[model samples]
Target: MSGGFKDAKKDGSDPAGTSMSNGHMGIREISAGVAGGKWSAYEITEMYIDKIKSMDDRIGAFLTICEESARAQAKAVDEKIRSGKQPGKLAGVPVAVKDNICTDGIRTTCASRMLENFVPPYNAAVIEKLINEDAVIVGKTNMDEFAMGSSTENSAFRITKNPRDVTRVPGGSSGGSAAAVAAGMVPVSLGSDTGGSIRQPDAFCGIVGLKPTYGLVSRYGLIAFGSSLDQIGPMSKTVEDCALMLEAIQGRDDRDSTSYRGEYQQDYAGRLSGDIKGLKIAVLKEYFTDGLENEIASSLNESIRRLEGLETSVDEVSLPAAGDGLSAYYIISSAEASSNLARYDSIRYGYRPKEYADVDELMEKSRSEAFGTEVKRRIMLGTYALSSGYYDAYYKRAQKYRKLLRSQLAGVFEKYDLILGPTSPVLPFKIGERSGDPLQMYLADIYTIIVNLAGLPAISVPCGFSRDGLPIGLQLIGPHYGEQVLLQAAYALEQDLKLGL
Candidate 1:
C-alpha cells in the first residue's frame, strides 16, 4: 500500500476533501475540478493515491500502483489545464486498467507471479487511448490469473474484496476495476469481460458494467485467454461515465486484427438518447435454470416489469445451450490459455528464478515457484485438451458447442432486441467461501460465460437487492455489433429503475 492510500472504513470519504456533485457529474467533475482550480490533477491524483494506499490493505483491488508515472502525468495535465487548453474529455480523470491489459513502463502482472516482474516496452491499444484523452493511468488492477476464475481469490497477490461487503468476493478478472469504481476510489475504470468479469462485479458493487461487442473494442494489447470471447469494457457509477470512457477508447485500432472496419461511430451517449417506446426485450428463460437463488430470480422479474412499464414489450425466450455456456467456455478458454501462456518461459521477458543453473531447471523453477496453482491447473487442462489423443474430444468438441451457443444466441436475436438475465446465478459469496472448491467457483460464472462464448455484448445494471442486502444484477445481452441497442436499453431501464446512478 502507498502512503497516500486512505481507508474507506476509516477515513470514510474524500481524503482530498473533494466535494461530491450529484452523482450525475461523474466524469464531468474532472473538468469542474480543473475549471474551478479547486484541485490540480496532481492533488486529485494524490487524493486517489491516498485513498488506494489506505483502502487497498483491506480491498486489495490494485496489483500495482504506478505512483511515479501517475504523479508525472497528473502534473503535466495540471500544466495543460492551467495553460487554458482543453486537456481532453477526461482531463485529469484517473482510470485503472485491469492487469491483463499491458501498460508500458509498469509491470503487467495479470495478478499472477508468472509475469510478476514483466514490464512491457509498449502500451496496449487502450492505454494509448486513455493517455491520448488525458486520462491518468492510476494502476493495474488485480484479476484472476489469465482470467481463469470467477472470484478474484485466484489472484496470486491477493483477492479483491467487494467494496459493499469486505467479507465477500469481488467478481474476477476485472474485480479490481469494478471494486475501484464502486468504492469511489476512481469515478471510472476499464475491465475485460471474457465471461462476466466486468458485469458480475458491477452487480456485486452496484455499478454499471458494459461488455461491448467482441470487436467493438480492439484487443491488440490485451493478453489473450479465449481469443473468440474476451472483450474489454467500462465500469462506472453511471451510464454517462461509462459512455464517456467507452467513446474515448472504442473505435477501430488497425493494430488489432479483429478490430472493426472503418469508424464505428463514437457516440454512445447519443445512442442512450433513444426513446424506449415499443422496443422488444427478451428475458432468457434459460438464465433462470435450476441453480439460481430465489432472491436474484425475484429481482430479475421485478426489473423485467420495470422495463414493461416503460412501454417496452418484454417476453420470455429460451437459449437452449445457455446451460452449456460454462462448460464450453472452460474448455475453449483453458485450451487457449494453455497456448497463450506458452510464451512465459524463463528464457525471456518474465520472471526468471536465480537459483537454477541449467535451462530446464530455470524454466521449471521459475514457473513452479512464480505461477499459482490455478494457473498451472488450467495450463495442464488446456495442454491436455490440445494434446493429440484428446484434441477432438476436448478442444474441437468445445468449439462445436461454442458454435451451437452462438447460433442459439443468433436465433434469439432474430425475435428480440435484447436478452435479460442474471449476471451471476447468485450474489457474491464469502471471501473464502469458494476458495477450496474450483468447480463451485466455476459454477458462479455459468450465467456469464454464454455471452462471452457467443461474442455478443452485455451489461450488468443494478436491478435490486437481495433480502440479505446484496445487490442483484440484470444482464442485458445483445447480438453482435449491438452496442447501441445494449446501451439504449440499459439507459432506459436504468432511468426506470431509479436505483441511484
Candidate 2:
C-alpha cells in the first residue's frame, strides 16, 4: 500500500484523483495554514468551493453548494484573526455536513424528494459546534433518503460514485460525505451512522470515519431515521482530523436527553499518545467468513501483523451471534423508522400533494409520490413489524436479539481493549451493481452494523487496498465511552502505515 501511494505520488495522481498534497492534507494542516496567514479564511473557502464546482460533477458528492454563506463565514473568521483574537481550533478550515443534518437557512435534502426544498430552522447541535469552532460549512453532501440504504444508489437525487473508482460506489448512506473528503473537496465532514452508514462509507472511500459511542454527540436537528440507532460522527481524511472533529462536536446539549452529560474527555487529538504497546486487541473470527472477500481477508491479516509488529497482542475471538447483526439491525431500525418517519404527513412541513380528497388522502398521496422506492420499502417493513400480532414476532424479538448482541460485545470488552475486524464484508461494488438486490447491499455492512447495535465507539481506518486498486478498511471498535482508546489505536495504525493520504 505504501509503495502504491509512493508510485502514485511520483505520477502526481493520488488514489482519489487529487494531487498527493491535497489528498493528504487534514484539518490540522488546513486550519494552521489559514490561521498563520499562509492563506486567508475566504481564500481557503474559495479554493474548496471552486474545487467542488469543478470536480463534484463527476463525483456527485454535494447536493447543495453554500457558496455565499460559506464566504460570509470565512470573512468573519478572517476578521476575528486580524483583530488579534483567536478564531477557534477549526478557523478557516472548510468542512461539509451530511445533508440529513439540519443547517439553518440551507436546504438539507436527505437525498430524498420529500424534503428536497426543506430548509431547517435551526442548526444541528454538531453544526452549531462546528460554526463556533470557525469551521466553514462549504455545502451539504448527498446521502441515502432518510439514511436507510447501504449504497448511495438509494438516493433519489444522484448516485455518489467512488472517488477511487468512478464506476464503483463510495458506500452509503454517508457516501457523499466520504467521497467529498476522499476527493479533497474538504478536509472533514459530519455524517450520521445508524448501522454502519458512516464506517462502511469510510471503508469504501479509503478514509477515516468515527462513529462515536451512542449519545457521545447530540442528535438534535439531525433528521431522525432510526432514532435509537442514529448518531452523528466525523468523517475525515486522517485519524488526527477525525479526532479534532470529534473534539469540536462532542459535548452535552440541553435539547438532547441522550447527549452525554457527565464530565467528558476533551482534546481528543491532543490525547493521542500513539502507544498501543501491549494493547489487547481481539480479531473477530466470524468476520472472515465465507462471504468475506479474499483480498480483504489478506489485507486484514497483513494489518494484524503490522499491529503485532507494534507490540500489540492480537487473538481470535468468536461471537457466535455476530453473524445475526444484519437481520437484527434491519428489523430494529425499521421498527424505529416507521415511528420516526411518520412526521412527513404533508399536513406539517414536507412536500404536499396538489390535490387530495381528505387529510388522510393528502398524506398518503404526498408520501407515495415523494418517497423513493427504498424509503417506501422500509416504511412498509417497519409498519408491518409494528402491526398487531407481528410486533412480538419481529420487532420485539429483534430487540431481545439486540440486547444479547450488546451483552456479547460488552463481555468481550472486559477482556480486551478493542475488537478489530474488516469494516465491510466485501470490497466496493460498482454503482448500480447491487441496485436490484437489496439483500446483497445490506450484507455490505455485515461487519460494521454490530458496533452500532451495541452502541459502541468504532473507527474505520485505511488498512490496505484490493487487487483492483480500491481501498480496504480496518475496523477498530471500542467499549462505550472508549473513544480515546479507539482514536489512539487508529492513530498508531495510520502513523505506521504511511499510505501518504
Candidate 3:
C-alpha cells in the first residue's frame, strides 16, 4: 500500500482526468503523452523495465520477462511515431501479456516444464492486436500452468505473491498479470480466464479485471485448456482501462470459428454514466451462503447498497443449479483439457525427455517429470472423464449440466439486468494454506466457474476491504455480450466509493 490511487490527482489542469496510479496509465494518458510528445513507446518500455527490475524479485509474478523483444518493439514504435505516422490507438502504452498467450520467438510456457523451452513461431491473435495497436509487450506474466488452479501456487515456475500482502495468494491462473499490475510494474495485463483467473486476482489485488463475453474476443493461438471456457480479456487498475483494452482486441477472427460476428457491445465508455436508475440487480443467495467470510459478504453488500442510490433495485434470487456449475465445470473443462493437451506429445512440441526404449515409457516419463501436480491431477481427471465407459457419466452429464446452466443464466437474465455476487467466497489465503487438499483450493472458484460455463461477460471490482486489510470484490454478471451494463454498473460504484476512479 505504499502507493495506491495516489489521491486521484486528476486536478483541473489535467485534461485526461487521470489518477496517479503507479498501477497503470490508461489508454487516454498514454495517447495524450504520445500526442504531446511527452512520452514515447521507448520511454514507456524503459519505465516498465525499471519497475520490473526493481519490483519483480519480491513478487515473483512473472514466469518470463522478454526484455529485449519489448525494447526492440518499443524502439520501432517510436521510430514510426517520429516519422509523423499515427502509431494506432495504444500508441506508446505498456501492456503485460499472460504467459498462456503465445508470442512469436518467446518461450510461451504456460509455466509448465513440459513447454519450458517451447517458443511459438506465431503470435496469438490478441498479442498481434496489442502489437498492431502500438502497445509494447512488457513481458509474459506467470500463471497456473495450463490455467488449471485457483491460486498461482500451481505454477511450476514460481508462486505469484499478492502485491497488497505478500503473504497472501494472488488468485490465478492469471496471478502474475494481476500481481504485475497491482505491483505497479505495468499499466495493464492480458489474461485468459477459463474461469475466475482474471477477475479473482483483480479482486485479490484491488484492481479491475474484465472477462469479456466468450466469443467477443478471439482465442486464436491461445494455448488451450478448457477451450469452451477459456477467454482472453483485460486486467488493469480501472474499468476504463479494461474497456479500452477490450475495444482494441475484440472483433471477429476467422481463425476462431466461434468468434463473435459483430456481437461486441459498443459505446462501452459512453455508457458509464454513473447512473443505473431502474436497473434490476439480483443478489444470488447461494453466493453469500456458508463458505463466504462475513467481511467479504458485508463488502459485497456495501457495493450493492451504493447501487441502490442510482435508482437500482436489488432482490434475492435462487440459482439452485449453480451448485452444480463447479462440479460440471470441472468435468467438462478437464475433459476438454484431456483432448486439448493430447497435442503436447513428444512428436511435435514441448519437452521430450530421455530416449526411452518404448513410446509408452517416453510419454510416461516426460509427462511425469514435466507436468506439475495440479496439471497431472487435471489431466488424469480429464482423461478418465473422456475415457470410454465413463464418458457418458462424467463428460456427457457435464455437457447436459452446461446446457442447463446456460438455461439457468438466461432465466436469470430475463428477470435481472445483472446478477451480483462475491467473486470468491473469501479473500485470498496464504500461499500454502490450502495446498494440502486440492479440493479445498478448487472450492474458492465456486462463484466464478459458472460464468465461464454460461459464457456470459463479468467484471470483478474492488468494492471495499476487510478489517483484516484483504480486498473484497463484487462481481457483476451480465447477459451474453452485455459489457455495457456490466461496465456501467461497475463505473457507478467506482464513482461512488471513490476507490480508484
Order of quality (lDDT): 2, 3, 1
Clash number for each model? 7, 0, 0
- In candidate 3 the C-alpha lDDT for residue 97 amounts to 89
Q: How far in Å is the alpha carbon of 498 misplaced in model 1?
A: 1.9
- TM-scores, all candidates, are 0.93, 0.96, 0.94
lDDT of 3 by residue, 228-268 (tens): 99999998878888888888889899999989987566557
Q: For model 2, which pairs clash?
A: none
Query: Would you give me the overall lDDT of model 3?
Result: 0.84
lDDT of each: 0.81, 0.88, 0.84
Q: Which runs of model 3 end up more than 4 angstroms from their true locations?
A: 1-24
Candidate 1 per-residue C-alpha lDDT over 213-236 given as tens digits, one digit per residue, 9 for 90 to 100? 888898988988878778899998
Question: How well does candidate 2 match the true structure in TM-score terms?
Answer: 0.96
TM-score between model 3 and native: 0.94
The lDDT, on a scale of 0 to 1, for candidate 1 is 0.81
Give residue 64's error in model 2 in angstroms. 0.4
Which segments of candidate 2 are over 4 A away from where they belong? 1-23
All candidates in order of TM-score, best leading: 2, 3, 1
The number of the candidate with the highest lDDT is: 2
